[model samples]
Target: MKFAVDPWDPTYGTSLGTELGESAAQVALDVELPSSEWQPIDPDPWVVPPDAVLFVDGVRRVDAQVWVDDGGAEAAPALCASYAAGVVCCCKDGAHLLTADVRRGLFTTADAADDVRTTAGTYRATRTAPHPDVAPAQLLSLALQRELADTELAAAAAARGGHDSVHGGADDLLVIDGPLRGRQHLPRAIGFVKSHRSDYLPPQLGGVVAALRTGQRTPVFRLGSSWERHTWYLRLPCRPGAPWAGVVRVECSADLSAGEAVGHAARSQATLPRFASTEYKDSRAPQNLYPIAGLERELRRRLGEPNLLYRALRRAAAA
Candidate 1:
């Protein structure tokens, strides 16, 4: 037997986890092609990419974990997180940042908790009610993510509206760097998932994903979780290694027809590979496209220094 290393840096975790569990989402594999005909589809060289490609990403940092002094017998645990979202637009002229927004929040279920105003930044109090199904920390994290998602949507809208003057009336493609759960309503938008945690496809179709070569993609399929979306798998350019190296899942809103989803899938083949990052430049290369990497760095910078923010929070608490 032969073993191959996954190109993703170990610190970030493997691109594909070993504990592949079946997805709870209802999956329809025949949206674009019959299961019997499943195989990697080569990119259509003739399909021209959109005139402009917008890359949207968000970064969040937990500045500190604190205990809320609510009037209850015991204090409630809360998290102070700083999150920022941004968009980078790539067109015939060049790639440049379009919009970026930063937000800070105190997430807790304590009814008495108020907005946190520190010297560094003000974290608006976000009430995240406890869920029996989820942990408190995870609930706080999810609340932070929801704020980030909203910021991302705003950034995307601002970018699109602000750039039309510079890029003319040319068509654009919106690429969200993670799952498209909340942002699926955006037009011409596709979710760019860099890694996999669940096995959404059956073993027969999973073989198709493993067999994909650079610049190739699997046929579009539908995934229904809490929300529904059409998705496909594409292999980005990367050094030969793991069977799933450079693989990423691309998805679009289920509101689109199957043919339209297929069109987006084909257009992705012509578009995304151009921005694929090399291992030398990115720890999550290929999957983490260049524009997205730069946007993430910028967003994190906008989030401010974590240590400074933490100290500010501590000082505020002391006062």
Candidate 2:
């Protein structure tokens, strides 16, 4: 599964007209999937072949988790920072106890020279924040929104002549981390995906509907505020019947998420495209900022386990 997007596509939900509070209220009710017809995915998170592909339908980031750690000195924020180590992480689902030795832990990508390295923590830590400026809950929400936005923005920017030709290549799954909603951004994204139903997404969202038609891998999601909360997003294979269309949500919440560590990787073994990343490492610029090419090479090299780059994830996950 591949995602070819259109950066020019009007960014909805960001502008006015709809009150932010009301918009959230509108999404309050869970868009129910006709369970009788749509089959949810297996809650037990599994691994996809390293070569798997993902077509991101759309991403709507509700920065609600920020509130979970609104107070810089809040308990949730501290806990979020501690768990950001990539093990024993918490979310809305409960707890996801990750074992560094068992899971990929983090993903590193270095530039050609391997001078500057960037390691995006693979497991729970990727979503945690230890600084007072960014509380854990707030950062987690932002991470979800930003990562998905990177994929969407990248595909859109990479499209050619109004047609997105990116991830059309046949692969296993195209994972877009989020939930499903009919209206708002979710519905609009689905519309685009259905239009591009060919190898990649059709003019609109052909790829999205196709994923629904052909059962997609149950997308693994972490509960933003609490790692303990585990929600599974599975597009029923062929959608079983009409009306109960593409994308199904499976609630696999538990008292703790410690055991399901191995299944929490962002992208396993597949070719990782360049993502507009968070301000994880880049704090100052010019005087202190790393060069663009240098950053890329270092980022890739450090994160690329096959090479010798700074192993931030290994250290963090173990912490």
Candidate 3:
């Protein structure tokens, strides 16, 4: 099944040639200027900045409008099915630090004894109850994970398809908010803890991964905002030994470099066939996306990739 993998917060609010404030921004996908819409392929031997890992596209300017079509005849549904999932692997606990510290340990006070413990630098109160540092960090760790129950792999393995659908029309597509562990993200983040730490994947991923591999299906990873606000950067798949594999950067938050994005797309398009032939296949490299069509047009104008406009025109013709 043809799959399109996109991260939840791939757009960068910061600016061009600049990075985000979070340390995770270190892993952002670099953008470049867009290519000419008149030509299909970008200029050969395209020049790139020496430090640029991911280049921007050619079209640095953009304008787009949604074209609504209401046909009388029955339109064909997606040839296959679609599904979506969002996973919150980590949580943010900075807000509740003070309230947690003020009520540390058992004192049998009038109010519910403050069982919450917070970490150092978690808040700005500059006051603490002389508790251990581990307590606060542990407390702060529950922000993203607050919703996920069945914490043990053995307790129940995972919660069944609780809330996996979010896409507009996804009958044949099954999308996950995080990696399926069939890829490289987890192994790198938590390390291979024996058989890689999948205890955090919440079981749904386990069943999905089993389906993808057994059916020779391609699964899409849609890294979400829960991870975005903290993690900042995400991964993309590259050809094994392709020099850029395991490459990651902050999501889409940098200035546009002249042809980097398109070059990378071209590279991906050309590399797909060869990459498809390899056993070490993956689709989790870095990604650049804009939630707002205007932002996408501006960025695409800068980088020169106008797949949006072309797709629109094609639809217009079929109409």
Candidate 4:
């Protein structure tokens, strides 16, 4: 088969370099960046309570059609539909014992017909119904899936119980797969960031982050954004080359006092590395914890037979 390919000219490399250089320069604008000073902490200082921690993650897939029409002469909108699913896994004695709950749903752009308009910095109001075509529908589908997944985790956190109480504290930790975002306020919850966007520290400090040894973590530092949190980087045991080869960022609510924040940091340094996946088990091993990888597989499996679901959606639209 003949394929057209975009030619890589000399200008391409220069353009790419300029973009990356600007990105690195932009890091300085993040006033919340941590100081260059930091110290390494040992992971052995803490003990994880049995069956008191939960890990949450989600998965989604979209099925679309080119041209869809109602049963009669009525015009049919393009169908962009998907299944969004999430799972909550409870940890016990350094192992994920069982799935506490599974949440999933089928969503489509057609359902956005009655959505009201709103003006917000982060939210763009959809005044008109979404187009049935793949592009428009798929965008709406993805947004819906993300919302559902976050909602599921929030519900599970509520049911599992909060971190501590005045009468007696609940010794549970909620480890979310990605940034806590809107869910940061959840009690005893923390966000696990697998990918790094920009440097959150100066070069010298970042060097310390890169040099972190297995089971070692950087000193906890406060990060301010639209939300506030204490953040640190930890290294997992893995075959490594670069400084950040096995490093991952962990974030906890800044609402905690200094002592409490340090305690949570210690618990994470000890608990997370134990769940790190081997290179043979995952392409993104070490950073992608084994329990999270397993939970992702389980959620995708619960999405059901894709072909069957696709045909059902088509049949329903036709009818």
Candidate 5:
């Protein structure tokens, strides 16, 4: 028997799981190369790294769960959530936070729900009609996630607007810390997925991903279903471990030509490994790049103290 220890801390869960469900989306393996020709592609040494790399991420917390009384037969359930999004730009001058936006929201389905104000902060009421497919709590959580995504978009835009002022005539690449679902319209942006939940490729193709060496990537493939995007897997620099250790999935808008997607794949291989974190520094090292880890800390800090916020909510409810 043979086995390998996953470098990622167990508390955070393994980077890749053995039980992966098949993805619902349709995958086209021929986008960059036919399935028969699948293999690891090394980084293009000629592919120049962007002058600046913008790392975007968001953090959210459920401060408290509350009930909203709106004169209805039954009280409506609501959640008080604090979420924040931000961007950090890395360039010749070094990494600096470019933009950060913190927001609080009372997510509920109650029509009479209004903005919640507390000494700690205000959670503007965000009403979403209940859906049969989702539970109330899950719906509220989804609403909070959507708000965070929107904030991330705005923060990225703000960062791009001001980026040139700091580094004149510099080309920049935008790396969003999650799926590019709603934000695919952004130019020069790619989603950096740190973990795997679904098996998007067949065993033969998956072997290619596992075979990828540090700073190498699989051929680009198109995933289509509810959404469409070009995606590939890359391995970050890390000690030898599990077959799938140090792997990360990168995605770009499907609007790009296959050649363009391949170019982005090359660029990612050439660039992202430089920011890979070490096990001693991060529980989710390698896949969770250094800038993103730092940005997450800053964003969580901006969310304020959860205990104090919860106390304030309690007081507001009593009043």
Candidate 6:
């Protein structure tokens, strides 16, 4: 039997089916699925002058059971366990782990020193309401996740500085797994978007996205919304499935000149394809680069043994 996963949608009883049908129809009419018509880019030394490429991503998980006063029935006290980690690597050399930040026992509600760890990490207390409707436990979990992301970015930046000091200001490129909104000033840094949640391009430009081939990339263009950045699409090498299967969007700092942006595009086209993961190596395959995959595993490991942390939290909360 094929297992299917469904999102927690309140509209499932109402507009979910209608929304899906409309979305499918819109994709058929407006968007063209990716094809193998992209411009092939040769690996050029001038394009990728960086000594290393740093891949940065964050992970967070909440253990509501950590302090389940009433067996996690309703409005129970909870804690968010979060951590951030970074990895830096080059094509020739493997990955080097960076210092990670871990925060545990972040309280879900406003309480005065409810637990030992919570009291130690005094900033873990949630004062303001995140949302009027969301449950307290969920809100605290969301807040912890946001905090984790910020910490990851900071760790990534610190790692870059640390690497520079060791390697004598080597020109290293940083590839963050999400949008580079707050990190606009990071030199030689680019955001790597894996999923296609929204159509950033117009109908005319949809063909350009569709034409991307393995190890090929689209032309650089300005992506403007709340934040602006020079972005391009690159299809990583992978076992063929669908047109857009291995496509990843790369975006660089908008503060750069046009030439610099184009340079970043070229660097991404050359560098990213080298790190593309195969189906055998990763479940996510090409979009989840090798360094990134390893980095994620390392981060989770650094987050401490899950069972141990949970038990400790439970015991501390009971005290």
Best by TM-score: 5
Instruction: Tell me the alpha-carbon RMSD of every candidate.
Output: 1.4, 21.1, 25.4, 9.3, 1.2, 7.1
Q: Which lDDT tens digits does candidate 1 get at residues 220-319?
A: 9999989999999999999998889999999999999999999999999999998999999898887989999898888888888888999999999999
**Local error of candidate 3 at residue 223 (angstroms):** 20
**Residue 62's C-alpha lDDT in candidate 6?**
61
Model 4 lDDT tens row, 1-319: 6543211123323101222121222122122323544556677554664346677776656554433332445433443333333434454444442333333333333433322111211111222245546476556565665665565565555545532332154466778888877767777778998766656666566677767889898888777756777877888887756556677788887777766777777888767887788867776776778878887787677666667766655564464
Model 3 per-residue lDDT tens digits across residues 1-319: 6543332222432111132123221212222211111112222334322111111111111112212222424321110001111122111211110000010121111122122222211111111222344453333222212211112111111111221122222111111112222212211111011011212222333332222211121121122332431111112332333221222222111122224324333333222221111122212222222111222233333322246434533453364
Residues 1-319 of candidate 5 have per-residue lDDT tens digits of 8888888888877778768878889999999889999999988879999999999999999999999997989999999999999999998889999999999999999999999999998999999999999989889888888898999999988888888776674798999998988889888999999889899998867889888888889999999989999999999999986889999999999999999999988999878999999989998888889999999999999999999999999999999
lDDT of each: 0.91, 0.27, 0.21, 0.59, 0.91, 0.65
TM, every model? 0.96, 0.23, 0.19, 0.71, 0.97, 0.78
- lDDT per residue for candidate 2 within 1-319, as digits (tens), equals 6543222113332111122121111111121222223332332334444332222322231211211223345324211111100112122343222211111221111111111123533333233334568645555555554454444444422321122233243233223323322111221111111111112111232233334433343333333331233333333222133322333333323332433411332222111112112223422111111222232243233223432222442343245
- 105 Cα displacement, candidate 1 (Å): 1.1
| Root-mean-square deviation of Cα positions for candidate 2 versus the true structure, in angstroms | 21.1
Question: Which candidate would rank higher by TM-score, 1 or 3?
Answer: 1
Model 1, clash count? 0
Stretches > 4 Å off in candidate 5:
none
- Clashes per candidate (backbone, < 3 Å): 0, 65, 68, 1, 0, 1
Better of 1 and 2 by TM-score: 1
Q: For model 6, state the Cα shift of residue 99 in Å.
A: 2.8
Q: TM-score of model 2 relative to the true fold?
A: 0.23
Poorly placed runs, candidate 4 (over 4 Å): 1-36, 44-51, 65-80, 84-142, 162-170
